[model samples]
Target: MAYSYEPHHFEDFSVGQTFESVGRTVTESDFVLHSAFSGDWTELHTNRHYADEEYFGERVAHGPMTFVLATGFVYRCGFLERTVLAFLGMNYMDIPAPVRTNDTVSLDMEVVGKKELSSREDSGLVTIDTEMTNQENETVFSGDMKFLIKRRD
Candidate 1:
């Protein structure tokens, strides 16, 4: 059966649920814009000559950029649309592979935990495991994210 995502409610999420995202190819403009926006002007992420001389042999995107992309992908999946209260935190973040410019990336997530908030009956906490991969199926990033999810009235 095609899994139907539920109405805005804390009970919608369950352990082991996974979501996949549409692909987005990282470009030079994306790399530059993020570098400028975040003030992360690292040579590896911004300078081709420096990056080419380094171990990875080419310019790579910032890790934070990938993080933003993954989060945006989750939103794009419509999993938490109008249902999220606030971002809690993240843990176990890892960049397993290089995120080079021009590499297409996709995100996937799995729900790991859920708990009702003691302070708020209309919301709950959720933990998710996220992985981002490149066109070659190499894992570029992995991490856990926490969110405060709102329930319907």
Candidate 2:
């Protein structure tokens, strides 16, 4: 069984294991807050009228915003809580579809790799293949995330 609400150690992970995160809905306020703090005035994310004439036909959430939100949703799953030592990196991020406002999204996370570090005996590395899909099951974001996780010694 998956540990959705409990902490998971490096030993708890396996190469083929997968987990699904709870869904989160994007909103206009999400865009506004992101813009207010980031000071980005990109029309594709802020101006609906301008975005309506663009390729996606409406405002799309900022690329970074989608990534950040997806990360937060994964964290809310609590599987890594108190067990992660650090975030190593994220690789090959792709926004295949627009993350529109009011779109509900969830993360499908698969453990791509896991290995103990000889030099750092207290921790190990975990690599995750992630796909963030919207309400219609369209992959809106995709990436591989790596992190340092504590060993169960």
Candidate 3:
């Protein structure tokens, strides 16, 4: 089914609403660039030779990179566009599986909870359960993300 690219406000969200994002292929360039940008040129993510000897048996993308890409995929869905006031925070983030080069990943987001902000009538908080899965349907990352979203009223 075709997904809409329209923004969704706080009042538009309901518990159990889910969104599936477009897939993105992770690449060597992604690792290299992420390492360079984050100043985290760790051998596990950069040195294939070292990584080849490690538990994963090959270079793995940095954990933060996975989260970043996952969020990007969600943004591409266009639901949070201008309606999102701020990213409050995340909770219980987990990287259960390694994300390697050429792995296509997609994000599955479900609205788990919502709370009206007594301090701000113009906005509210929405909590979503996020799981990022690879092409093989293995969960690479999971977390709960909270966002302050604008209210339509």
TM-score, cand. 1 vs. native: 0.92
The weakest ten consecutive residues by lDDT in model 1 span 1-10
Comparing 2 and 3 by lDDT, which wins? 3
Q: Please provide, for model 1 over 1-153, each residue's C-alpha lDDT reduced to its tens digit, 9 standing for 90 to 100.
A: 223344345787888988778888888888888988999998888788888899889887787898888888777777788899898889788988878878999888899988887899889999999999999999999999999998777
1 versus 2: better TM-score goes to: 2
lDDT of 3: 0.91
In candidate 1, list every pair of residues with a backbone clash: none
Model 3: CA > 4 A from native: none
Instruction: By lDDT, rank the candidates, best first.
Output: 3, 2, 1
Better of 1 and 3 by lDDT: 3
Q: State TM-scores per candidate.
A: 0.92, 0.93, 0.96
Q: Mark the regions of model 2 whose C-alpha exceeds 4 Å error after superposition.
A: 1-3
Query: In candidate 1, residue 69 scores what lDDT?
Result: 82
Candidate 2 lDDT over residue span 1-153, tens digit each: 453767889888999988888788999999999999889879999998999999999999988898888788778889899999898888678999989999999999999999878889898999999999999999999998898999888
Most accurate candidate by lDDT: 3
